[model samples]
Target: METLVFRFEQGQRRIPTAAQLVGVVSSGNLEVLVSRAELQAACEIEVNTAAIGFAPIWQAVMDDFQARWQLADVRIAINDMGATPAVVSLRLDQAIEACLESAP
Candidate 1:
């Protein structure tokens, strides 16, 4: 078992507006937690195990989301359990929805 840890501080202008949540549990299972903070929405992720040498792929997926959504003031934390890149996006969507529900 191995672990990877990282953190990001998002501004209030990077939060998503009306997001969705979705992911799969085959070869790639994701568990996410999202919340509305003083800035906006925050995210944290944890991955149990991965294919190794795939940081660039992960960064690309995350970057794509940020660019497409124009998220502002959103903090994200992710934990992946040997999940594929697609699963990451799915879990992210799910977490985003959770944020909307919890948003004030």
Candidate 2:
């Protein structure tokens, strides 16, 4: 399968996280989880955030995720700590990339 890869972090702070994809957590204010799901299951996105007013923004992020990846049977869980939409998107992409790269 051809996977989309990206450079999550730049400079010396970049750490290879592909090996830690399984149950791996990323970002400080925004924690994201990318894990495998049953083949028959659909892509699941669960977001727990304190900012209730950002529902639309969150929905957009979910939509973007669906469009960007073929996540027919993947589970993505996110815990947001007042992060902006851009940050949320970045973290999600990083998490997915890590998960795919680590797949055996």
Candidate 3:
């Protein structure tokens, strides 16, 4: 297993009050946990993945996610079991949607 962490500083909004978990961690799949945190105007993402030596690819995905969401004071944890990048993006989007739905 490998762990990768990424931080982005362009966040424009803080996450909602409620935390959200989405997807199932299984073969060729992943799970995402999203929540608000004291990130000091940054969005942090931690990925624990079974596929090793893919940091560059994961970094790209993380960069894209940060660009699209611009989340602030948010921490996203992802557990990946050899999932594709597309699946990873999808799960992140789903988690964000579910989390934002609980917004006031």
Candidate 4:
């Protein structure tokens, strides 16, 4: 098992109104938990994976996600079990979408 943490400073500080979670940790799958945070124009992501020796790939995937979203003041936790990068991005997007939909 390997764990990685990343923090990014996004100039846009629009936080979601609520927290959300999506996906499940299983063979070739992962779970994502996202929530509001007091990060002050930043986003923090934590990834725990059963697949080792893929830090570079994970970083690339995360970098792409951050670029695409540009979200701020959010904390995301991903429990990964050998999921592909595509699935990882999908789950992350879904979690954020769910969170936004929860807004009143």
Candidate 5:
């Protein structure tokens, strides 16, 4: 299994209106955990699986998310196991939803 971890921190600036956390498992699986903290917006993702040769793609996806959402304050952690790109993105969106819903 392989692992990828991406972490982001968002300060007090009204983070995303909604956060979601989705898991993708295909002979592998993905798990994401997001929480609020006192710091800049950030994201932490951890991916674990057997699939290889796709680091840049993963990073690109993440980068795209940041660009699309214009996120500057938040944290994201992803755990993947041979999950497809679509699944990865889905999980990320879900994580964001979760974060927003549990925001205090």
Candidate 6:
């Protein structure tokens, strides 16, 4: 699938997360928290990182995430430890996939 530009607007119905999935943040790891929620109008993403001047990069990642999934009321909490953009993206995908796989 092609990556589309990310926009902040009301999304589709919230996708239910079957369980909490965590991706470790190490040399080749990224910690991610994916969960379902009853958001008011948009999805919420909280990204905590040690890297400085990386807000734009994270925004780009979130853009891609919003494009890839219908996270209307989903909550994604991420903890990063100097992981590259590619790694961050990978972890996001992994977290979403895990949620879908575990869904009833």
lDDT values for all models: 0.55, 0.58, 0.89, 0.85, 0.60, 0.73
Clash tally for model 2? 0
Using TM-score, rank the candidates from best to worst: 3, 4, 6, 2, 5, 1
- TM-score of every candidate relative to the true structure: 0.58, 0.69, 0.94, 0.92, 0.64, 0.82
Per residue, candidate 5 scores C-alpha lDDT tens digits across 3-34 of 66655455233454444455545323776555
In model 4, state the lDDT of residue 78. 95
What CA RMSD would you report for each candidate?
4.7, 10.8, 1.3, 1.5, 4.0, 5.9
> How many clashes show up in model 4?
0
- lDDT tens digits by residue: candidate 4, 22-97: 8889644899989888898899999999899999998998899888888898999999989989899888888878
Report the poorest 10 consecutive residues by lDDT, candidate 1. 11-20
Off by over 4 Å in 5: 5-28, 102-104
Worst 10 residues of 3 by lDDT: 9-18
- For candidate 3, give the lDDT of residue 74: 95
Better of 2 and 4 by TM-score: 4
lDDT of 1 by residue, 29-99 (tens): 66554443454343333444546767677767766655554445454555566777787777777666566
> By descending lDDT, how would the candidates be arranged?
3, 4, 6, 5, 2, 1
Tens digit of lDDT per residue, candidate 2, span 1-104? 11112211111112223223322233456787666544343666677776666666777777776667645555556766677778777777887677656555
Predicted candidate 6 versus true structure: per-residue lDDT over 1-104, tens digit per residue? 11122335687756556446667777465698877766765778887777767777878889887888767767777777788899888888888777777777
Cα distance off (Å), candidate 6, residue 73: 0.9
Question: Ten consecutive residues with minimal summed lDDT in candidate 2?
Answer: 1-10
Residues 41-72, model 3: lDDT tens digits: 99999999999999999999998988898999
Q: Kindly give the stretch of ten consecutive residues in candidate 5 with the minimal lDDT sum.
A: 11-20
Error of 5 at 91 (Å): 1.3
